[model samples]
Target: MLQSLVPLLVDGLANAALIFFVAVGLTLVFSVLRILNVAHGSFYSIGAYAAASIGLWIVSSGFSPYLTFPALLLSAALVAALFGPLVERTLVRWTYGKSEAVQILVTFGLFLILEDLQRMVFGVQSLYEDTPMALLGITEIGGIVYLNYQLLLIGLAAVVIIGLRLLIRHTRHGKFLAAVVADREVSQTLGIDTNRVFIMAFALGVFLAALGGALATPTSGVAPGLGAETVVLAFAVAAIGGLGQIEGAAIAAVIVGLARVLAIYYAPALDAVAPYLVMLVVLLIRPYGLFGSVTTRRI
Candidate 1:
């Protein structure tokens, strides 16, 4: 039992870290931008592809191996810098203040376009480069070999949670974002440039989603339809924690992670439905969400 337990917890946290990144980004977007962004998953796959490509280049070119860490960050930055502003300015901006149906449709359309663009650029086969993982190596735990890279992921997730909290709570952009979240029209009336805020929020959302993808590249394969699978899990996390609650997303991620782990260990049939099952129960009780509340929807 002890042998099984260690690997299970390790696996759960590893899975949780990636989903946490994507889910938190989704929640943040909803909190500030108020968009469902069904296509948000595309950014994830793009980030993963970017990371794998960059990591592979570094190794193939004989660059210093330590660069892989920076490569992870750069992959996300590159995706965010390129696609973030472009998508926001062109398509996402058009959906602002639109109905939920329109927002979903536009973003989903963008998702399809971006997904195809990735295939055109990278082709359909999977890509992965684990220089980072190779550097860290492995650990022995409970008769099982655990990758140190996995633990690194958990640390990364914690840093992101704290970093995001500070970004939203301590910084100027955070205050502006908070104001937007509080009341968009009022913030605009108060001389806050809502358009720019929207751009920033959308870009940040892209950054987080892409960062998640980039981080996963070292351990996971990047391929077509990857975004689709990841998006469903992220949506489950986002919904379970409450659409706009950051802390809630984190806690819910852990719970969902553990639930999945337990399902795989004891009741394999529940593995797929575990997270959503928890979501269903929580929403049934709270309606709004565990962290969500029925409040004014004015934007």
Candidate 2:
């Protein structure tokens, strides 16, 4: 049991890393915009499609398989760079200072539009490119074989956590973001361009979500409904971690990840509900979430 558990934990973290990106993006957008953007998941699928396409292209063109890694990041950057500001400027901007219902509705519409656009561009067929994963090969840990790519994801997640902390705690932009979070009106009065900040943060959120999808593409198929599934899990992670809590997202991702892997390992029937069940329990125990505080949004 002890040996079995180590592989389970490692697998859980690997799954959690991808989920963390989408959840953290959602949480970050909510923390700053004070609105839940329902369409954030669209970016995830878009990223996956982009990555898979690029990866396949690289392979078909007889390019170095090593390019797959950069292709993943580039795919995400392309999505964010192209659609992020457009979504914010046209749709999200309208939701500013609006009721939660209105915000959700607007983003949901955008989500539908983007979803259809993706189908039109990439078709309904599922797509995947695993050269990146194959190239990295596998490693045996504690007698259990694990993908080296999986371990890389864990390391990447750690770096993201540290990078985000430094961005929030030590940068000038971080101070502005904090100011806006603490008191929007005061920050506006203090000469901070809230609109610019909003755009940047939303773009960052898009990038993160896209990156998650991109990274997962080598191992997972990109399907039409992938975004919807991803968004739902991201929501669970965000909720369990406490809305707007970055660290909370990390912890919640691990908790959710562990629950998922454990369920898959033991009671396969419970795999689907595991994350939400955990979320329900966490929220029931701590309304503000594990890392969330009632006073401030921290994601």
RMSD of each: 1.6, 2.2
Residue-level lDDT tens digits of model 2 in 211-233: 99999998886999988888989
What is candidate 1's lDDT per residue for 10-69, written digit by digit as tens? Answer: 889988888999999899989998889988899999999999999899899999999999
What local distance difference test score does each model get? 0.90, 0.92
Output the worst ten-in-a-row residue range by lDDT, candidate 2: 290-299
TM-score of each model, paired residue for residue:
0.95, 0.97
Candidate 2 ranges beyond 4 A from true positions: 295-299
